[model samples]
Target chain A: MFKVGITSLCLSVLLVTSINASTSGKLLLSGGVNQVEGSAGGGLTPWAFIGGYGTEDEIGANAFITNVKSSDYNMVSTGFVVGFYNRFEFSFAHQSFDTRDVGATLGLGQGYELKQNVFGAKVRLFGDGILEQGNLFPQISFGLQYKKHEQGRVVKSYGAKDDSGIDFYLNATKVILSESLLMNLTLRATKANQIGIMGFGGDRKNNYELMPEFSIGYLFTRKFIAGFEYRFKPNNLGVATEDDWLDVFGTYAFNKNFALTIAYAYLGNIVLKDKQSSLYTSLQVGF
Target chain B: MFKKYTVCLLLLISCASTDKLSTYHDFGEKKGIEKVVDDLFVYLLKDERTKESFQRLNLDKTKEGLSNFICVTLEGPCKYEGQSMKRAHKGQEITERQFYGMVENMQKAMNKNNIPQRAQNKLLGKLAAMHKDIIGN
Candidate 1:
């Protein structure tokens, strides 16, 4: 896990080395940092802005490394993203979930782990979150993410229905410019259990569910932002009850190319651990 | 079911959003706005991305117009008697970068003028609505 995070950062640094001259761009922090799934937006809900540092007529790329640690477990997620013409985006993210003692207790092993890869794409459907001062409609985006979990044997032993699948979502982001407020609402259809850490389905059911996620932020400056996020997860596995998640976070862009983020999250549950709260942090470099 | 959905929708709509005009006016009185406007031009003139567009600009008129614009936009006791926002930048070929650059300068000016973050953001929020109109490209 440690090596994975280091490699993610190294790759991001390599990605940022090739810089393309930029044109006009979105407000700082408005394009959003890389979400856990490697999509652009809040720490959870993806925003409408295209990934990377590009504006409308230019091209840009970015890389991010994130780590979340708690008393019960730890996780590392990292990925790279490319934005084309500020209208479309493509991204790839890798995540490692370490079960620690819980895996041993669950009869798996002392150091069992679950790893997954997520590939995502998004398009700006319509509206400009920053410009709609007079309009009620917010900027909207449609996105799809395909998630595949490794360690299929462990998931199968736990009664998972599948090891790979896709999650579809539509996001609406609005900037109440006068109020200096940023808001996002995401509607997702998914069936992964514990985000596929424990597998896809269980005795409860084997079907997809429509869920809503949201984030609201306030810009302290052109370079700093503070916000809150909420995401509703599907409880496809019945062995352990799943809970919705929420977090309070802040992000600061040192410049256009690098940023630092910190957050305290209430992750609800993680596999067998209940009230799985944690401290989350990530570094992002974009061009 | 329909009534429940309507109520939720209305709640969301209300959640979508502010303070009244007078509270906003306190960010800067007329004198404060003048200083912020001056500081804004200074930064704009210094910014490489935006300096070119402002080179041939008229200083006095721009300052006077911007001060009034800020005041009136905040519903203060002043009227923006200048040309419309669109007409003022008609042929500048203003790119998105320049537009955002201008906003950055404005924020710096507000910060230098000792404007509180709350007031500065409120002012910015008011200006953000004009993003579409400000960009000529």
Candidate 2:
């Protein structure tokens, strides 16, 4: 499985290198960075923008790698996304969660890693978020993500009802050019526990919970933008409490094909740890 | 939460200084606008996405019209003797991509003309409102 993921990522990189100069449409920083789940968005949540520089007449794709590190845990996520004619988007991501010392305490061995694969699809419903500056309506989209955990039996023994789950979401986004600001709000219905890292549903809840996520950004320049995001989470696992996530981020576009994002994120509590604050970084290369 | 953000945004827009005179001066008034218009055409004609659309245009008339339009948008003392956006772009079949191509060209021109970010945004804010009429009517 790991080998497959690596090979696909390599192919994605090659795709980017070969096609970047030919693909151009969306403005700089308009597509947003690759979120943890591999969608086009902020570091922690998905935004309504499709996933690349593609215009309505063009097809665009990109590959990204992200890392988040805290005191007791580290996470690395890699993915590729394709945007079709700026209307529909398809994405795939592989995530690895390192338990570090906490793995030893749980008898799961030191530096134990949990792996998950996410596949996502999104379709634009209506509205032009960027160009239609005269209107108040935002660009909206509907999306779904299917996630599969590698260690199904291990998570089930810890009270997870399933190791795989689906998440449905609606996103609204607007770019108020007058203020050089961008705003996005996403509503998601999910049954996953800790984003399906530890498992899906648990003893506390088996039904899906609706959560809200928000991102607000100010464009300081055509090449630079800074923002804030908050994502609500569902605590489906009774054994460990889950908390909401928030981050303050800034992304700088080195050019049309390369962008770097850095953020300070608060993941609240994860499993046995509390007040998990960490540094998050991501690099995106696309057309 | 969305409602609160809307209210905040409205407040910010209202509180922003709307001194058009200062903004116009930031662009060095009429002379600066002409320079920007000239540079704008250079970029627009060079960009592959927009070059064909503008290749047949009457360069001098378009430049004068654009300069006048921008001057009036900045609330300067110029009278725009040009056609309305709807009429000007009618039957042109412009795509969203082409529209954005023009926007980027305008940005490049503004940067070259030493226009401040705030002034540029103010100008774009007004022009962006006309996109509905300019794009694929």
Candidate 3:
């Protein structure tokens, strides 16, 4: 109950902050993890993910919808974003996870679904594209993400009942290569309860996990890019776990206005209990 | 490897010959003016201080007005109806340091874009003539 109250208070604060930040500008869509930085589809361009738009002088906004599908389950997520003074961004995302077979195994029912909402904000403390000192390094950004999990069922059988918690993450990202051939790196730490469908159940201790993400891409021509990213995450869900997953992805742009991305991910098993892996797809449009 | 080298060598020779056109005839052609102005634009876009200052200006509109400005200033067939360079830039608080910075940027841009050094120097000579009218120093 105390944890739930704390989560609600934090969410309220995030909402107020987002409302105050709306005057700055809407959030802009970012390229995905395939680009080695943040988002998979539109994240590599300046101010693509960490909010804002480009640098400290422009304002940008973005919206996105993504779907992840596996053999037994599926998840759909949508988000709103805004950037201010080109240095800060505030965002909100709601993710719904559908468990297709929980009813048959547990006698609860079939087609059980759960939802997790994540509220996040990021600030670019330093770096600028206008100050192009070298091609080896470009910009750096810091960000925080807060997530809440809501269970869809009340039978208290499939997993934790009324599972809701918060995870805080700090991330740093940089572009190691530029223009024609680009590369990016990101390191993040989180304290969330559950990673995906399985709620954080073991010991209930705040664990700091290291997530290192990398992406390398080539601009086949001027308006198109083909790239991939490998992201490492901890598989521990309070029980037993295995290795992380590798997201292999690609993207294509139709000009400055529209783009599409497709990715195949291999989610390693956790505790030798269940095997989880899936394919993800996203579409993005911008002005 | 030898064939590639021979091909590169021949390409260099042909390029050098094409660039040897007489200065008098070249100066009057569209290519010459374009070459000079593009070089100048490149330099102006490079300097951090100049770039910051220039971003505040209506460069897209200013660029559109450049043809007329150049035609009249360089004794071409057209007469420039736009404001003089000094008058247009007046009170913008631009200093000699900033002007030179812009010129340096142009130099770098020219080199990066592979514009020949001779063409760059010729364009610089024209810009040098305008310094007195622009900087008032």
Clashing pairs in 1: A24-B97, A177-B125, A178-B125, A178-B126
lDDT of 1 by residue, B33-106 (tens): 99888888888898898899888879898899989999887777888889988888887788877787888888
Model number with the top DockQ: 2
Model 3 agreement with the true structure over B1-137: per-residue lDDT tens digits: 99999999999989766633333233444444555556666556664556766666676566546655654444455556788777877767655446555655555655555554445444444554455456522
Expressed as tens digits, the lDDT of each residue in A197-275 for candidate 2 is: 9889898889998999999998888889999999999987877899999999999998778889999999988989999
Q: What are the C-alpha RMSDs, in order, of all predicted structures?
A: 5.5, 4.4, 12.0
lDDT tens digits, residues A9-59, model 1?
776666555543442365666678998889998887788878876667677
Task: Give the RMSD in angstroms, all C-alphas superposed, for model 2.
Answer: 4.4
Runs in model 3 deviating more than 4 A are A1-49, A52-55, A106-108, A129-135, A152-172, A176-179, A193-196, A201-206, A238-242, A255-257, A270-277, B1-137
Candidate models: Cα lDDT each: 0.81, 0.88, 0.50
In model 1, state the lDDT of residue B85.
82
lDDT preference between candidates 1 and 3, better one: 1
Better of 1 and 3 by DockQ: 1
What candidate 1 gets wrong by more than 4 Å, as runs, is: A8-24, B1-25
For TM-score, candidate 1 versus 2, the one ahead is 2
